[model samples]
Target: MQPNEIAEVLNRPLSQELLARDLTRLAYVATDGTPRTVPIAFVWNGTEIVMCTTTNAPKLPALRHNPAVALTIDTEVHPPKILLIRGRAELDLVQGIPDEYLQMNGSYEMTPEQRVVWEAEVRSLYDSMVRIVVTPTWAKLIDFETTLPSAVEELVKQRAERQGA
Candidate 1:
């Protein structure tokens, strides 16, 4: 899809809400030529999705070999609101822990003092991290009310045709 079209989907209210969510299931190709999908934390800056992980993270190697990725973010409620995104991952090795890492974990409940201690531990442990950035090449929002899956839409059309006959 064109950049403008992707942006249009991303700007929808449901998309915006999904972007605010902390968890996203990232799908990528593993070295063995198999598919891999894992739940991870992410921060969506208006333009791109940022995911931070340890430099030695297993997924980092896989991502480096295959930068192409797909992300799914959705609500758990019935007739779930889902945001599907396809993008290429850009891996950046940043010195020290990235601020985005802390920001992405901000929603997790923790006392102020606990946060301080956690930050200290993190600062001391990781000297560098990999920031996985993805710029959306395509995006779609499925809220079930206004939009239905491709299969469902086809079924609806078939049903309507039979009913009319």
Candidate 2:
């Protein structure tokens, strides 16, 4: 999709709401050519989706080899609202903890004291991290109220033609 079109899809209110969600299912290809999907915390910084992981994460090597990826953020309720994004991952190896990692994980419910302990543990555990950044090249928002999957939309059209006949 064109950049403008992708932006249009992402700018919708439903899409914005989904973007604020704490986790996204990141789908990518493993080095062995197998597809993998893992739920990971992420932050959407208007233009990019940022996810952080330890330097030794198994996915890092796979991502380095093949950067193409897709992300799905959705509601668990019936008539689910889903935001789909396709992008290329750009890996940034940074020393120390990245602020985006903290921000991405900030939405979890935690008491102030618990949060302090968690931060301390995280700081002690990782000396460096890899930032997986993706600038969306395509996007789609599907809210059953206003939009349906392409196949479903086609079925609806066929049903209308049959009824009209």
Q: Estimate the Cα RMSD of every predicted model relative to the unseen true structure.
A: 1.2, 0.9
lDDT per residue (tens digit) for residues 37-88 in model 1: 9999999989999999988888888888999999999999998999999999
Candidate 2 residue-pair clash tally: 0
Off by over 4 Å in 1: none
lDDT of each: 0.93, 0.95
| lDDT by residue for model 2 (115-165), tens | 999999999999999999999999988899899888999999999999995
Each model's TM-score, in the order given? 0.96, 0.97
Q: 6 in model 1: Cα distance from truth in Å?
A: 0.4
In model 1, what lDDT does residue 73 have?
Answer: 98
Say which candidate scores most in lDDT.
2
Q: Give the clashing residue pairs of candidate 2, or none.
A: none
Candidate 2 lDDT score at position 4 = 96
